[model samples]
Target: MVFLIQKSQNKDSKAIHLKLSEIIASHQGTSNRMVNIEDLTELELDQLRKFYVQLSKLAAKEDA
Candidate 1:
C-alpha cells in the first residue's frame, strides 16, 4: 500500500511539472530559465523567492 501511494504521488508531481513547463514555454516574456526549476538547490530557490518578493514590492510602490 505504501508503494502504491508513493507511485501515485510521484506521477502527480511529474504531471504538474510538465504542465508548468508548458505554461512557461507558451507565455510571452516568461523566462526559459524557469523551466526545470524544480532541480534548483533549496538555497537557490530561496534566493529566487526573495528576489520575487522584492520585485513585487517595487511594483507595488510604482502603482501607488
Candidate 2:
C-alpha cells in the first residue's frame, strides 16, 4: 500500500485492478481500483469534452 502511494506521486494517473473472485474468496477488497476509460457512457463522454473545453479556456486566461 505504501509502495503504491509512493509510486503514484510522480504520475498523472494510475489505474488499479482488483479481481472479483479474489475479493470474494478473501472477504476483503483490494487496495487497488481504477476507472475504465474505455467504458465511459455517451453522457460521461460529453461531460468530459465540456470539461476539457472549459479547462482550455481557464489555461488561456493565465496567458492572457
RMSD of each: 6.0, 15.1
**What ranges in model 2 sit over 4 Å off?**
1-35
* lDDT digits (tens) for residues 4-60 of candidate 2: 767554232211111232233243554232235335444554565465557668768
Residue pairs clashing, model 2: none
Once fitted onto the true fold, the runs of candidate 1 whose alpha carbons sit more than 4 angstroms away are 1-28
Candidate 1 residue 50 C-alpha distance from true site, Å: 0.2
Judged by lDDT, which candidate is best?
1
Candidates' C-alpha lDDT: 0.61, 0.43
Among residues 3 or more apart in sequence or in different chains, the pairs in candidate 1 whose N, CA or C atoms overlap within 3 Å are none
